[model samples]
Target chain A: MMDKEKIKFTDEELVARFQQGDERAYIELVKRYKDRLLNFVYRYLNSFEQSEDVVQDTLMKLYTSAHMYREIAKFSTWIFTIAANLAKSELRRLKRRRVVSIHTMGYDDSEYEIPSEDFDPEKETTSNYGEKQIQEAIDTLPDQFKTVIILREVQQLSYEEISQILGISIGTVKSRINRGRLRLQKLLKDLKVR
Target chain B: MDCYSFDKVISDYIESNLSAKQKQEANEHLAQCPACSEKLADMSQLLGALRTLPRPVTRPDFESRLMARIERQKQQKESPFIHVFHEYSRVISVAAAVLLFVATSLFVYTSVVLPGSPASVPSASIRSVEPAAALPAAAAGVRPEQAGGVAEKTLPDTNRVQNPDYNSRIMMVNE
Candidate 1:
């Protein structure tokens, strides 16, 4: 039984240990990634609960598919790729379940309107209000731009790292980050104004 | 650098991707150009906000929840088929029993009951009669008795009366 506090294995080493049936290594691996993965997924999903679930799901995959984790790729890259793919598919599932109420009750409504119909004023006065606005701005971005921006700006991943994760060229990552940032700037200009 | 060229390199400039010489040129252009400088400032502020955005912390039980979930997942993956079977075990067993019952019943009917029935072959023999049953009252009684006896016995000797001359004599006598 390894000391939970004293185990200092790297992700790859821990994964190797996990494959060797070290349950402690698995716990340590989950501890190492839970927060970072949660933050990364929360930014992409814009829902903390869903992000938590997705992180759990991602870790579960990492646990079960430990044998599939060859050492050729960095464990962070492989794990982050799993996280990204799960987040993307979750977004697709959410999108499919999202009903387009553009012509509700035979009345034309703006499709791009932020769904503040259920907004609670009490919740708006809470802490980190600007952060919520910024998140909403990020949420308005296109999926391609949204993904690269979150991976870059939020996760602070290098362009080359993001390129590998997204399977795109570094040039594409750079251009997307630039475009995403510019779009975000436009959307959040009002935040600066206030 | 003119504004057009500055626009293209501004992102690289903010990200520190520009060469030193190009950086110096951009700095010189920014010194002379307030518009481009303000654009750069906006981009910087945006990047700062994004980088400094407050992240939500996972709850204290995040690991426990994940581990519990992982354990559940491992148990499921260990027996994916068993999980499905367990979920629908009653329905599946009932369906299997019903299918087995139907199959066994069919097997018994075909192999034992059907082949042993005396009426099975004789029913085919009764259908063999074609024209001679039209001989009026006399032949009608004979036809029915033959048809009835054919159900319990092998076919009667129809080869005797099936002769054309015999049929003609029987038809003349009847008329």
Candidate 2:
């Protein structure tokens, strides 16, 4: 019998409990972070399936490397750093496995296509294309701007935390967010004009 | 404040990052300039929309699925010591092969390649100093002093000097 109230602890407290071998604390941490991380990674990688995989790897790292977690940084920052690195590595791998353009071959081929099984065609069709347009606009952003936007807007993390996770200065984080939002604004305006 | 300065810090102003003086300057510029004001409105709206974008949902069983995967991972993991060994297993195997090769080469050189006889040793020079007169009739002919001459005559090549007398002396000593 576990107390539901214990789940209300801050992430740092829960991580401390987890380091002390409290499995329930680990579950609580997962419950608190999984959705936010999934969204952040999905926006970064643009594939729901790979985002889920990256999140899973990040959590597993937390579990196995609990002893390595220090109290100096926010747990969210540390976890996001892991997830960001994993996402970047996955992106690099996808780059290496370049998908041959459909124009290259006479016939449509799915074998060399990277499988994104979690993509929901039905949902894409239902939203009157607002969500899809926004997603596409976001997709057009360079990796740095895309990451800054996702972390700032989606995760709602503070500039300091983002700077720590990105290993950049706070000034850099702020400027990047400003530039990203400006780019997003321009993209959205263009989309609306059409 | 002119439009140029206000435009540069509009984002900071919108996000409340501007100081009081900078904020006042931006406000004065926005009051008179319709273009700057409209731009500010659009930028704020854009920021609002971005903030309001729906958060993507995780599957309902996300936690259970993750926990199951974690359990599998834990079970599959090797023990710490074994894991360390497994990580360096390639290097360890390569080093072992190199060491075995060196030891084998040394053994072959000492036992089969360098010595003329199995009984010949590091102290072969001491044995060679023994008088041929003290030798048995069979081994007397195989004097150490004549060894170089017999070897040179029979086989000039360095590797082919298998002295028959040395082998016979070794066999006799063994018997």
Candidate 3:
């Protein structure tokens, strides 16, 4: 019965309750956001395992930093901001490790294999092919464009929400999304021709 | 509208964010320009694909794992003071209240109640006798023990200086 009542509360209200040390409210917030965060982080990182870790870290941050949330912004915006920052940090860390590994690889190291960035679209068929191509196209975009694209298109967040999450003006968000879509369009066309 | 101008506003047109005049210009450009029309169509398709991308779900144990981590965090966050306080908060609070009550009672007894008590009467009387003790014994021709009474009796004349007699009395004392 109490669970149903909790369900009726809005995300902001749930966060408010969590701020006041209500454990159930925190659980409800987690339940509400876990899948959404996973989707966002997965699109950003492109690895299920890593994305899961990022989402977990994001939630852990939420748990520890609930007091930092202000009612000035929507709870979703704040949580997504946290998830996006973590995902970006993880991406940078991965890139650093990749660079280090490449530099450290010895010519005689038989176990070392350089990872391939190529995706074989021939292996994907029909609906899967389109999705794969779109994902690859998205991956080709710069981080600024990719973030706005995913937030606007995949997560269907508002311009204002994306702006708040990315800490940019709404005009910048709009421009980035427009340019990102244009870039994706060009990339998908190129991929199709190939 | 030229292809360059249309390109700049195409996204806004697709989102219906353009002003009426600008949107109309875009519509006219799209109608005439096959390349721009195709571009718009492709963008629309891309948006659709993006919106329909498969959402991944976390593992079934995700919540349980997260909860366990939260529990661990909660435990870790408890400093020694917080831990001890949490364990014995009621007793500590009660003891604190009792201590505060005793301290307050002591303060009131000393500051407000004690001053009016019979135990303070002797000190009050001693304070009152201080002025009498300050009177000169030689001036009153009395010993220190009898000075209080004699000083009270001679109080009026002490203020009136009978110069010669006072000088003679002082000489007698010296003698």
Candidate 4:
């Protein structure tokens, strides 16, 4: 999905160029993964505005920490690690604010719009509700389970790649996704209640 | 696969990501049991639906906003915020050290050790420039008066230096 006119650079090329202070490569990188990274964070926190803010912070981190990247891992994997850390930190800050008993700083998950026409795009008419139930069940799962499940099922990353991003063992990633899926099945079990 | 084993295999089966032996076992089980096959169908469909879910379109200002924010941050980092503070403190410290060294050296030179100057320049006045400037003149003028006083007071004392007897070996050499 990369543009052919531009030099066919690997993620590593873009990273190396970025480290050498080439804004073009960084721009290319931002163009490449901005939406994907934003979606991951958005789905994780379930807030578009907050995810946008995180994506900005993530790119800033990439720009600043470019030299800290290693050659062994994929550039996307390295970047997602930073995004995940920021997501973790932001989540912590929001939770602390919530505990003060003030009005919530971030909106609750109900405000999250799944980026799909799978739901009826037309507000005038409603279609099958089964899919909506599945989405809701997924939303109900805890953050850890949800992260693993989304990375595996939605992002379609390999277990090894997910492990590197999350900085957990592959075993843990598998267990978490397994647990997350089972939890979803449980939550959606009575949908067509046998 | 047994029902208990079926749970574990369900994920691998839905992903179509099982080992060969696991795949054979799952196929055997799915051929017999409708329940797991139904679950597998549902799970695979769910996964397929999720994978098909589109990534949200980034807002129009996304790149510019990110660039602006990152530029601000890079400027902050490049501004030498902490580095400037540290260097300023170092400059202040070195200046203080040099001042202290000069002050201490001046104190040792003007006080404590010079024998005749302790009389000519009062300790407190030596701290000021006037007494310091007067010291050489005072010593030069006093030398003559002392010479006359010595001639009148003790002619014999002149023999001590003029006498060949004291330091006679060196005095004879001078003579």
Candidate 5:
């Protein structure tokens, strides 16, 4: 049997139209990916505004790379791969500029203000210290553990997807996730996790 | 706590990341063991916390500004090599008209050419060069029958069936 195309017309047809100078298809693509890419980029940059810039830059890259878009993976994975790389590069740029991670460090996670009615079997504090304490603890983790944790927890990606995206063996992915969780537990040792 | 040999499998068991066989073995171990159960509970709690960390929201106007910049930057980043390739495709039909001219042409060249088909498939024949030392010395200590020949100018080249010189050489050797 002929291989049913992994990529539908919705995917390639939109890209092909963009290549053929249909700026409107580009618009549709931007609309489709903008928010999703923003979320991916936001993970890298603590600032929402900077993530917006990253998303823009990533889209421009995708448009020009339209012809290069071979349907090798789920478009979501491919696009997020680009977005993540861009976000990382942007992070590096800020590092070069010496924008101290004080933003990352001295976070007023007052915004994480959990509407404190209580949603759990155990009532946990929604204090800023808890967010900072958790962030500091996560930030201290080795980059390998840190990345897997963020991808699995924050991005809510599957272990298989994390394995493919990070180019690690599945065992390594599982190990890192396990190790990261253990570390996070150690960081929030006082918190009731159950 | 009873120290178990399969502590390495703890993470695997807690996550249910183990294969069915591994899970069965781990469960078997846990059924009789309480230490493993406590460890499993702790690990499960940690895993639950990690999976439940709140997903944050993206700042507004995040999409539109990104789209606008990508559009403008898209043109500057447009690859010139792609255009050159597309243009080169059009030049092919021009070849049908240009080759129609055959004026008197004296093509001069100086090169020793080794003639062979350009498209010929390659094959290699390996001929072994055996040294005379490799010839086995038989019972009389001269040489074996199978690898008999140790080529000498004095010895008759009797292997050549068509050569008349073979009979003279054989007679001289016999006498």
Candidate 6:
């Protein structure tokens, strides 16, 4: 009965409880956000394992820094900001690692294995291929457009929420979402042609 | 509206964010323009696909792992050393302050007070030393006899020699 009651509490209410040292409230908050954060982070990183790590780190930060949260900002916006910042850091770290690996490779070193994208008759269908194509198109977008597109289109967050998470104006969020969609349309069209 | 202008307002039009007049203009333009209409269709299709994309779930043990990490973090926060420090912090601070006060008082006594104590130097020696010390006063314009008498009358009886040999050495070194 208590668990069911906690499940009904809003994210902000849960955070407020957690601030007052309610351990169960923290657990409930984690349950509510973990998968959502994983999905958001995975879209940004395109790597499930790293996304999970980023989400864990984000929750850990929330655990340690719960006192820093102010009631003025929406709880979702604050949590998503932490997830997005960590995802961006992870992306940068991956890029740096790739650069280092490239620099260190020698002619005698074995060739890096590229994952095959061969069609699987049993496992993959038309919808799967379309989804893959759309994801690839999204991946090709610039960071700003990709983030806005994922937040607006994929996550289905309000413009106000995206603006708060990204620390931008609502006008900027709308413009970015529009431009991101336009760019995504072009990328998908290009993909279909290929 | 031409294709370029229609492109500019397409998103606003789709989102119903345009004013009625602008929206009406966009509608009339869309009716005649195949290219602009196709662009809108493509954008709609892309947004639909994005919305329906499969959301990935975390691994099965995600909760357990997070709880374990949180437990470890709690343990670290409540570690014995930190716990002890927090418990005794006020007492430690007060002790430190008292020690500092005592050390400062001792330093002041040894450096400023002890050297001036009468037992460190007899009062008779101070009176005898004052006459020799008055040579500098004499040089500064007072007559030697007047400087000696002034030094004798003005020098405090409680004055002690800082360096035991400071006055006698000066007297012997000069004489």
State each candidate's clash count: 0, 0, 0, 1, 0, 0
Model 2 bad stretches (over 4 Å): A98-129, B78-175
Q: How far out, in Å, is residue B92 in model 6?
A: 28
Report how far residue A125 has shifted in candidate 3, in Å: 9.8
Local distance difference test, candidate 6: 0.79
Candidates 1 and 6 compared by TM-score, better number: 6
Q: What is the lDDT of residue A143 in candidate 4?
A: 82
TM-score of 5: 0.53
List TM-scores for all candidates, in order.
Answer: 0.67, 0.65, 0.67, 0.64, 0.53, 0.68
| Candidate 4 collision pairs | B159-B163
Candidate 6 on A1-194: residue-level lDDT in tens? 65979857999999999999998999898889998897788778877678889999999999999999999999999999999999999989988987888889887975343221341212322232377777788789999999998888879899999999999999999989888888888887788889
Q: Once superposed on the true structure, which residue ranges of model 1 sit more than 4 Å away at CA? A: A4-7, A100-129, A190-194, B77-82, B86-175
Q: Which ten residues in a row are the worst by lDDT in model 4 chain B?
A: B147-156
For candidate 5, the lDDT comes to 0.59
Q: What is the lDDT of residue B73 in candidate 4?
A: 62
| Candidate 4 residue-wise lDDT, A1-194, digit = tens | 33563567988988887788877888998888888887677667656677788888898888878899989999989998899889878877766865764554345434444443332422221223244565566667898898888778767888999999988999899888887887777777766574
| Best-matching candidate per DockQ | 1
lDDT of 2: 0.74
Task: Write one digit per residue (lDDT tens) for candidate 1, span A1-194.
Answer: 46754356678888898899988888888878888887898889876667777988898888778999999878888899999999999988766655544333345542332212333212332223367777878889999999999999889998888998899999999989888877887777766576
Report the C-alpha displacement of residue B119, candidate 6, in angstroms.
Answer: 56
**Candidates sorted by TM-score, descending order?**
6, 3, 1, 2, 4, 5
Clash pairs, candidate 3, are none
Cα deviation at B95, candidate 3, in Å, is 44
Selected candidate, larger DockQ, 4 vs 5: 4
The local lDDT score (0 to 100) that residue A49 gets in candidate 4 is 70
DockQ of each: 0.23, 0.17, 0.19, 0.16, 0.10, 0.19
Model 2 residue A43 CA deviation in Å? 1.6
lDDT of 6 at B17: 91
Please report, as a value between 0 and 1, the fraction of native contacts recovered by candidate 2.
0.30
**lDDT tens digits, residue span B1-175, model 4:** 7867988767867667899999999889989998888887776666666666546667777888887877766666787876466659888789999999999987787665654345434333223223333344456776423423222122233433344443433223323
